[model samples]
Target: MQITTNPEGRTILVGKAIFTPDEVNQGFEQVYKDNVSRVKIPGFRPGKAPFKIFASHVGIESMKEDFTEIAARQALKEMLSGKTIRVVGNPTFEVDSFDGPLNLTIKVSFIPDYELSDPSKITIAVPKFDVTDADLNKAIDNIRGRYASMAPVDRKAKKGDFVYFKWSVITDGRASDRKKEELVEIGMEDFVKDFDKNLVGVKSGDIKIVMAEISSGQEPVEIEINIGEIKERILPNLDDDFAKTLHVENVEALKDIVKNELLEQAKDAKEEYIESMIAKALLEKTNIELPENLIESSVDDEIEKLARDLSKKNITLEMYLEKRGINEEQLRAELTPKATNQAKLDVILDDYSKENSIEASEEEVDQEIEAISNAMKDARRPALNENDEQVRKNLARIIKRRKTVGYLMGKVQLTEK
Candidate 1:
């Protein structure tokens, strides 16, 4: 057998597996032996049939097709062994010309070779973050609101008042049967912006309807609220007593706690922002040829993930697409860029891991699993046991990726902004 490869694209390969007449004869003989016992032929008992008779029973063309299939599959499998290319699914086989040299063409799709940009050249300006007095004051205000006392008021509803009412949400002119009581904190636009507009200045027992747009898609949802009761919140003065309520020594201690919390948050946000900038810079600087099939496969995986998330919320993918006024093809098209970027990023990271010798040792992986288990309060910890082979492999891969990214991030020069 003789094999040759031709490139249709950067990631698409057309492999020509030209078999000798002797090899073709051998393939035919093997196929006959494998199927002879199951094949029926007149005037003979199963395996005892003559080659001519068997060929006559199952047409010569069918025999040749079987021979070609077996030989092509074997040749492609042998050619792909030990190759670095990540094949996407199975190859497509086409018989170019069986009459001459038993020629067969196998089209294989794979991720093409890619090289990441030098990590030393990648630089990002990471902002220096600190918790200021304003941040502490903002946090204190939020805490004070949470501890505020609410008491029933006979007067009309006003800003900063808490209103208890029965709400019915209407969508596309259809009223939902899921009526429930809800509370709206007046003047807190984040809680209910439209509610304050229609509920303020209204006395108890007043019924009001408000049209609010939540989602950009579909018609505006109509909110019907039946005012049940009104209450005004009384906030305690921020002093030593308020600090004691939060288990702190005094107001000074509370401020310190809030400042520390804010500082930690600022640090986390800065790290995240730097990582995102690094990813964006890497992608922009590196050039990779992605396989079309791989992108499509990634898109399918994304769609499946979306379906699972929606299923958890008791919604179907079809229902979501329908509500968004899009077809499956359109959704796939919209997700193409995301899938492409993810595929390319995976290839880049894999290459980086290999070049830098980044690896996750067994001890490191075990420690990671233990840390995760300790952090989780629910049954989720058991789902990542080191005893599970797949879980361990996944954990190792994740750790390795993190190590690679961390190495790259360390190499990057950060310009403070």
Candidate 2:
């Protein structure tokens, strides 16, 4: 076998591999022998058929195709045996000349080679974050709101009141759906802009006709709502009683727990913020040529994740982009920089992890896998166990990346704001 490298672009290497006829003949014979036992011929019982007869039945062209494929894969495997090419995405192959010495061309993409900025010299200043009294108070307020009680009111509905009403929307001279009981918070514009306004000051048994322009470039929807009961939410006081409801000793204890939790969250946020700063600083300082395929793959992953999230809300990515008056191309273009940065960060982190001897132990990987498997439902447990190796590697990579980020973040200087 002979190999020649041709540069396709900045990050892609096109390899032309040519194998001698003798080299591929063995593979072709092996493939033929492997399939002969399964091949059915009229005059012979499967494996009893002569090689010539089977070859004649299957056609020589098919054998040549098989030989070309096997030889091309072998060439690629040989090329990557001791090479430093960090090939990323799937490689593409083209059978150049399978008639003679099975000539094949392969295109492989790799992350570009570049040196990272001196870690010791790099310094990132991040503001010191702490949970403040106001934060704790806000958290307590949220808890109080969660434990709020609702009481029916006889007067007109006001802001922050739950207004239960029977409503029907008439679009295009026809009522869209049957009259349904709907509850809306008077102040939160969960519906059209004028919906909350129409609900406000509506007394029980009042019939209100609201012509609302919910969307642009469409006729106003005629909505008829029969007002029902109004309920005002009364928040419980943040005192010992409320604390007892939450199984806490007292309000003071609850506040302490909330403050400690918020402080821990703030610490985590601070670490993440500092790590992002370090990444940005390192990106700016270093000159790296990222593989286009890696960036494209990352962009695809982002798009898929966005699609899944939007799917949960009964929306498609196309619908979202259309609502925003953009196309898939525009979305991909917007995500390109982010994807590029992510790819660069991954490469840099991997390199840093290796250089600094940062590693995820087997126990750490096993613990992560166990946590993940436990989080999964019983139905998916078997699948998780089946993909144990892949899961371990993915978890190990995540752990190593975090360790690398933490290492860099630890080196940065923090300034309190």
Which candidate number would show the highest lDDT if scored against the true structure?
1
Runs in model 2 lying further than 4 Å from the true structure: 1-3, 18-54, 74-83, 120-128, 152-159, 165-181, 186-189, 192-230, 282-285, 303-337, 367-387
Worst 10 residues of 2 by lDDT: 378-387
Question: How does model 1 score by TM-score?
Answer: 0.78
189: Cα error in model 1, Å: 5.9
The lDDT of each candidate is 0.84, 0.83
Model 1 pairs whose backbones collide: none
User: Clashes in model 2: which pairs?
Assistant: none
Question: Candidate 2, 232: how far from true, in Å?
Answer: 2.9
lDDT of 1 by residue, 290-407 (tens): 8788888889988999999999999999999988999999999999998888877877888889998999999998999888877774655443567998888999999998998888
The true-versus-predicted C-alpha distance at residue 272 of model 2, in Å, is 2.9
Candidate 2: lDDT of 107? Answer: 85
Clash count, candidate 1: 0
- Model 2, 187-296: lDDT tens digits are 88886666688887889899887887767545687878888888999999878988999999998999999998998999889877877788888889888887787889
Highest TM-score, which number? Answer: 1
Q: Scored by Cα lDDT, where does model 2 land? A: 0.83
